[model samples]
Target: MVNLFSHNISNSNAINNIYNIIYDYASLISGVLSIIGCSLNLFLLYILIRDKQFHTVSYKLIRISVISDILSSFTIGTGCLLISYEFTYDGGIILCRVVIFFTFTSNGVSILNLCLIAIDRYFAIVKPFYRRYHRRRKQIFYLSQIFVWTIS
Candidate 1:
């Protein structure tokens, strides 16, 4: 009975150790990637904002997408990093709710932006006349963005 109990305890400890290692590595990789992603997105946003030539509907959509990406990276990515470091927020339930809200909203916005891009491409390629019409209606893109935010 003593040997059995000792063996079970050792096995449980080993399993826990393995789990910790995996979680640590996963969190580290996710945090690093998120930082890289946010950096690249910010660079792209800067270029878009600096260049007047990029002030088109598509570019606007891209800018919105990048903004959402940055938000996600900052909120979710930072949370993951904190967890990996065994740090707790202790900022109460409101902070937790805010984090969750921003993370999900940003993710939703990102997805919606992609859908807008795809629709724009479809009109450009599959319906060239409609694409020309779209070019004159820049408000459409802005409206779509607003709609996305509203939904998110």
Candidate 2:
């Protein structure tokens, strides 16, 4: 019987219908975004890996960012699609936790890499002498990339 005292409505047809509509729209948006992100990431990876000259440290950092974004999109975007299609919490707790962790970690890493890139640029422009006197820009960039990945 319906929980009349608790004021919980027994007929949830309206709520369920609204949810279905929203989920479909969200799935469409997520799918489109995932495709775009994956395509851009693959293109970047191809440009960086195929051309030896593009192996400069700066490009390497960008490559890492692209990889992380691709992974993030795959996990989070696909999860959203599944949820939309199933319309149920079928992923369970473990899968849900793992997906969430990867999503958060990858997003954080992507942002951190961008921040490091900015810092590297500032150093390059502000202190040109330091680049020459100390480690080469290429080496410094590689080291910073490694540092960001390791920390992330």
Highest lDDT: give the candidate number.
1
lDDT of 1 at 149: 99
Tens digits of per-residue lDDT for model 2, 38-150: 78888878988999997755567788888898888787767666666654455556557876887887887888888877877677688767747257666766677677767
Q: Ten consecutive residues with minimal summed lDDT in candidate 2?
A: 1-10
Candidate 1 segments whose C-alpha is farther than 4 A from its true place: 87-100, 121-136
| Position 57, candidate 1: lDDT | 72
Residue 148 error, candidate 1, Å: 0.6
RMSD of candidates 1 onward, in order: 3.3, 3.8
Question: Candidate 1 — worst ten consecutive residues by lDDT sum?
Answer: 87-96
lDDT of all predictions, in order shown?
0.83, 0.75
